[model samples]
Target: MIESWRWYGPFDKITLPEIAQTGATGIVTALHEIPYGEVWPSALVASRNGEIRAAGFDWVVVESLPIHERIKRGEGDLSELFANYRQSMANLAANGVKTICYNFMPLLDWTRTDLTAPVARGGSCLRFEAAKMAAFEIHMLGRAEAEADYTPEALQMAAIWFQKASETDRDALLHAIMSGLPGAFDRYDIAGLRQALKGYEGIGRADLRANYQRFLDEVVPAAEDLGMALCVHPDDPPRDILGLPRIVSSGADITWVLNAVDSPANGLTFCTGSLGANPTNDLPALARQFADRVHFAHLRNVRKDPDGSFEEAAHLEGDTDMAAVIAALLDEQKRTGRIIPFRPDHGHELLWDAEKGTHPGYPLIGRLRGLAELRGVIAGLRHRD
Candidate 1:
């Protein structure tokens, strides 16, 4: 597997040179400064590649070529947006960058309720609390249909939780979900969220899936023509949020997309943390089943509760069977004869990183520990095989 690190361009707290010290040979990044619907110029891509090369690393993956909101909802001048996306793909291919990771989630990219949930080891991890999210949706954002999405008991709990929450807690919850953390693409407050939710008022699961299918139909061929792989990321929690439907959250959903496009260029970003949030998703089985289609991977673990809340766990210590999953990935690598680019996704804030202040789930020390652990697992699996 090709070990990689996600860098949020020049503004990231952890510089490219600092990342090099962790032994990651490849950089997974995007031109975050570029607006969503604009064409990514070939010159800009080359400049970014040059920066990475100068830092003694190769740019292996474009973590995202963001699908515009208009494209995701099937709204407003889609032909123009699709044209820009295709042009961006051509630019990346022209610059020798092949793998592109993106998501089709409507409002937010990935969300959490707590950015500093306490771990037993005295570090902090990102957490998603279902009731708190419900609280925000019901009492804060005042989504009229929010109650229908939650059970009576859950709704009651959320209301009570909202009543007891302090103003700081309320702000923190809002910031965690809507504002803070990397990859939100845009920030939102209560009014902004209410306005954003309005965009998906009539859109449901089936409609969202159809829109994504349409997107695939339009872009997959372009990606194939350029010999580039487009890997779609799964929903962060692998479920619906804020009354919006999540189309890419399950095996059936994945099957639908793969069959919808049916091209080698249309692929998956196998994120264990996201998929494993739902207990029904068998990590190792999914890895083996979609081995051929997985172009990039984000390997992290989460400890899930029965009530739909979860917190990031150490890479090897969560509900996910890391050993079995790694074995399956190794088998797939052998079968395909292609190096899979996998990164240690969403680590805790630990050691000096906790004090130094870093992106919510992207502290340097924590991820280094995760990468070292995953690397050891791969080494051991190869030795056994």
Candidate 2:
């Protein structure tokens, strides 16, 4: 496996030089400045690659080249959007960045109800509490159909939570959920959110899945022709939220997606933290089953509660059997002779990270500790072999 780190371009407080010092030779990043639906020019791609190389790292993977909202919803001017996406892939491939990770989640990206949930040992981790999310959706967002999505017991819990929540608590919840959108803090208000949801009024699971399949059909061949692999990220919670359907959440969903296109270029970004949120997903078993099609990995873990909430756990401390998953990935690498690039994802905020204003869940020292621990695991496993 190739150890990698995700760097959010030039503005990221953790500079490329700092990333190099973490012992990772591969950098997973994206052209975040490039707006959605715009083509990435070859010169700009080359420039970013040059920057990474100058910092003594290779830009091996694009954490995302975002799929435009119009593309996801099968809205107007799709042909132009598809053309732009293909051009971006070609530009990325021209610059020797062949692996691309993206998601098709509607309206928002990965979400959480608390960005600073305190953990043991004097640190903080990202958390998603079901009740809090339900409260936001039912009481704050006031989505008419939100109640239908939750169990009666869950609805009762949400009602109680919302009834007791102060103005500050409600505001924080809104911020946490909205923070998942790219630049949404400044760009989106409740009206914007409602309008976004309105666009999907008639769309359901089947409609969204068809739209995703259309996207795959159009782009998978282009990716193959460009010598690139396109990996779709799993939904963050592996479940529907805000009444929007999540098609890439379970093993069955993964199977449906891979079968939808049936091409090597179409692949999965195996995200442990996302899939592991669902108790039924056997991480090690799924890793083994999909090893051949897993083009990238997000190596993180989460602790699930009985009440359907979850928190990011230490890389190796959660329900996931990290050693077993790594062993499977190692075996796959040996079998296929391809090094899988993986990064330590969503590390807790520890030490000076809280003061550094680092991106949520991406603190320096926390991820360094995670990488060191993961490296040790790989070494020990190889010794046993």
Candidate 3:
């Protein structure tokens, strides 16, 4: 495994020099400033890659080339956007970059109810609390049909939770889901968000799945031609949330998706955190099954419930069997002779990190702990050879 870290580009509080100190050798990043659907020019790709290399890191993977709303809806300018995405793939390939990771979740990228849940580490971690989400949907965003999505008992519980929330709590809730927050696919005000959803109003899971198939058919060929890997990231919270459709949440979902295009260029991101958000997803098992197609990985564990509540657990201790997952990944690497780019995903906010303003759970020491633990696991597995 090639150790890497996700950097949100230049403005990120964690600098490349800081990342170097963590002993990471690669950077997982994308051009966030370039809005969705715009072609990433060869110059921009080269420039970004150059900067990372200059900072003593290999530009190993593109965390995403976001699938535009237009493409998802198959609506206005979608064909043009699809072509642009193809062009972006070619540009990245032109700069000798491969392993592009993207996701297909609707209206949101990834979501969590709390970015600062208390954890044992004397700091905080990002958490996805189902009740808090219900709290947001029903009492906060006031979604029209939100009350229907949950059980009557759940709503009753949420009403009590809502009663304790003050104006500050509401603002935090709004910010947690919006304001360029980590889990949300993208941030928009209530009105703008509704408008975004309006665009996908008629599009359901079937339409989205069909669109994904159509997209892979069109873009995977481009990727293969350009010698690039197209890695599709799994849905975060991996199930239906806020009444939106979720297509990439299970093994069957992955199998169906891979079969949709049936090309080596089409691949998976292997995000354990996203998949582990659901207790049912067997990470180690899936690793072997999808080994060859996994282009990048986000390895983190979650403490989850069937009710959809989950908190980030210590890298080595959550519901995910990290040791087994690591072993499977290493075995696959040895068999395939491919170095997979793996990152620790979200680290809990702790120690010196809590005092400083940094992206939540991106603290260096915590991730260093995660990376070292994972490295030890790999070493143990390799030594058993």
Candidate 4:
């Protein structure tokens, strides 16, 4: 595995020089300044790649090249969106960046109920609690039929949780969940959110699966022709949220998507933190099963509770068998003789980053610690492999 770090382009708080010092030789980033469904002019792609090389780093992967909502829902002007997405892929490939990571989660990206859940080590990590999420969807967002998804006990717990939360707390949670999209901020008002949810009111899991299949059918060939690999990121928290259907949450989902196109260009971004959120997912086994198709990796862990609450645990300290997962990856590398570029997916805000403000789960020192831990794991396991 080639060590990489996700840098949010020039606007990120952590500078390239600082990232270069972290012992990562590759960068996972995107042209975030360009809006969704817009052409990424080759000139801009070249310029960004040049910047990364100038900073002594290689552009390993585009952590995301946003998939337009129109494309996801198979609505609006999909032809235009697909053209733009394909052009972006070609431009990225032309610039020598091949691997691309994207997701199809409706309306929101990866979400969490708390951005600063305290860890035993006196640091903070991101958390997603089902009860708290239900509280937000029911009492706060007032989404129709939101209570139908939770159990009776969970519903009662949500009522109590919502009752105890103050307005300030509610706002904080809302901001944490609603904001943080690449190149976007806390501009998602209630009306806008509700309106967005309305678009998916009748769409269920089956419909989402079909749409995603169509997405693969339309884009995978272009990716293959361009000699670029497209990796679809798993749903964060790996479950349904906001009354929206989630399709890419399990091994079945992965198998479905990969079979849809049946090409190496159509691949998976094996994200442990996302897939590990669901306790049923066997990380190492899945890693091995999908080894041939995994183009990129996000190595992190989450401590999951039976009730669907989870917190981002330290890289090697969580429920995931980091050693087994890494060993599987190393085995795949050895078998195929292909390098998989992976990064410390998300980290707790620890050390110097604990004292300062930074992107949630993206604090510098926290990720540095994660990388170091992962490096040690790889070194120890690679020898045995």
Model 3, C-alpha of 34: deviation from truth (Å): 0.2
Every model's TM-score: 0.97, 0.97, 0.96, 0.97
Candidate 2, residues 1-385: lDDT per residue as tens digits? 8999988887588998888899999999888888888899999999999999999999988978888888778887699899999999998998899999999998788899999999888889999988888788888888868887767777888899988989998888887877665521324567788888888888889999989999999999999899899999999888899899999998999999999999989999999999999988999999999999999999999999976789999999999999999999999988989999999999999988899887788899989989998999999998987
Q: Which 10-residue span in candidate 1 carries the lowest summed lDDT?
A: 178-187
Query: Could you give candidate 3's per-residue lDDT for residues 84-184 as a string of tens digits?
Result: 99998888888878889998888787787788888874878888777778888878766768777777767777888899999888778777766323322
**TM-score of the candidate numbered 3?**
0.96
- The total number of steric clashes, by the backbone 3 Å criterion, in model 2 comes to 0
Write down the worst ten-residue block by lDDT for model 4. 178-187
User: Which residue pairs show backbone clashes in model 2?
Assistant: none
* Residue-wise C-alpha lDDT for candidate 4, range 1-385, written one tens digit per residue: 8999999886678999999899999999988888788999999999999999999999999978888777767786688888888888988998899999999998788898898889996888999888888888899889858888777777889999989999898888888787447665325866788888787868888888888888888899999899999999999868888888888999998998999899999999999999999888999999999999999999999998878889999999999998888888899999999999999977888768965566677899989999999999999887775
Off by over 4 Å in 3: 179-186
* Ranking of all predicted structures according to lDDT, beginning with the best and ending with the worst: 2, 1, 4, 3
326: Cα error in model 3, Å: 1.2
- State which candidate, 3 or 4, has the greater TM-score: 4
Candidate 4: Cα lDDT at 291: 93
Residue range 188-280, candidate 1, lDDT tens digits: 878877887788889988888888988998999999889999999999988888888998888998998888988889999999999999889
Candidate 2 regions off by >4 Å?
A: 182-187
RMSD of 1: 1.3
